[model samples]
Target: MGSLRTCSRSACERAAVATLTFVYSDSTAVLGPLATYAEPHCYDLCTSHAERLTVPRGWEVVRLALPTTPQEPHPDDLVALVNAVREAATDRNQDTGPGVRGSKGTLEPPAGAGAGGARRGHLRILREQ
Candidate 1:
């Protein structure tokens, strides 16, 4: 049997056969050898952390460039990647304020004023000028 190891990350204390391997570029940990595993490679982690395992802060995750086989990527992978990119784009947009192009126009209030107040509905059309 292979020797057991613990996660090198300071906050973790999981024991497993394989410790996460990191590659260094210049003075930084640039990537990992086991980053793209379809399942949790390490053991003893809670469900949440195990599900979201990846290269830590300051490490640039290097994706595997292997040729794709007949099998397609898992749906979970597509969802995770898309969600990550969306979150990153949102963060960048918030910081930069909608990029080179100005506002895509403004959001105006609904056309008709409600009797007492605005009645919340499923779909409300904005009155854009």
Candidate 2:
């Protein structure tokens, strides 16, 4: 089951109903419906915050109309999600194959993997534009 996304505003614990993305090149801010997945560079906002959103001086704000009612996930979306999870699990198992375990029964990064080497982690750092 999926968990509710919270607003990105400080001390605001309201459920997010919109996603805010900034287009630096156009000096524009886009406020749209909640994204399927959370993005590092985007902000998730509640209805109130989204409605009251303000952009920097000279910046344009583009508001995308949100749906009046929540909708169920499509079958295709559910299938895709399941496939992605299975692929990730397969990849993880392959990386931590036999003899790659630490003495403490923990998985160790494969040869030449990690910081200053091949990336092997559940989380990835997004590069700034």
Candidate 3:
């Protein structure tokens, strides 16, 4: 059976309940629901770690508005995320050396893409219009 995701914190085996992502450009940490798919750079944290999470003195954590209870993950969002991961993995395995020609690579997403490059359903911190 597929097991629940474990916390990203080293040496811990507890199932993750939340996800944490860092925006290094702005020195901000964004904590929200468990990601649809775990991106390599994002952190999957267990309840205890998430509750006690901290950052360096100059950094900030922005906790998005989460529902009072755990809810089901959206099917469409999960599918999109899984597809993105598969595409990325496939590209990695293929040789992209200069000797290979006429390969149309996946285009980079335009600005406003969600964190960790998932296409949709993310909690974004937008500036006032």
Candidate 4:
């Protein structure tokens, strides 16, 4: 989905919460939910602009139900968060083997930590004795 769009009305910089479109044949102005993609003929409006919208003398105004609350996080986003936490936990657990101190006083990964449990990047997880 696209980021929050600003109201199309000039000089009004509020985030758009609704979309407005006109039906020339029916002489009606429709105000509803934000469009998936902005169209040349559709106008994106903020809460104030959408509520105060007016049309020509003979034009009818049709207002569709607007969302009362903010949008929730996408399911994919939640799943990604969970996966990242799991990966971090797994990495920490794999580094639990006692670290060996080299001649240079640098801690080295346990012998079996090679190949499969190879340390990633320059950072290593340290556990208290």
In what order do the candidates fall by TM-score, top score first?
Answer: 2, 4, 3, 1
Ranking by lDDT: 2, 4, 3, 1
lDDT of each residue in 1-129, candidate 4, tens digit only: 434688999999988889999999999999998887899999999889999998999999999998875455599987998679667756655566335332222244556663444454665534333
**Model 3: residues >4 Å from true position, as ranges?**
1-3, 66-129
Off by over 4 Å in 2: 1-3, 74-129
lDDT of 2: 0.77
Reference-based TM-score of each model? 0.24, 0.57, 0.51, 0.56
- Model 3 lDDT tens row, 34-118: 8878899999887789989999999999997644555555789779996897687467547573336754344445477555553
TM-score of 3: 0.51
Candidate 1 or 3, higher TM-score? 3
Global lDDT for candidate 1? 0.43
Better candidate by lDDT, 2 or 3: 2
Candidate 4 has what TM-score? 0.56
lDDT of 1 by residue, 10-105 (tens): 686653322233445532322223223424533332223434557657666433332222233578987998679657766766666754464322
Report how far residue 78 has shifted in candidate 2, in Å: 3.9
lDDT of 4 at 42: 96
**lDDT per model, in order?**
0.43, 0.77, 0.74, 0.76
Instruction: Summing lDDT over every window of 10 consecutive residues in candidate 3, give the lowest-scoring window.
Output: 120-129
Best by lDDT: 2
Q: Candidate 2's residue-wise lDDT over 12-98, tens digit each?
A: 998888999999999999999999899999999888899999988999999999766555567998799867965776677677764
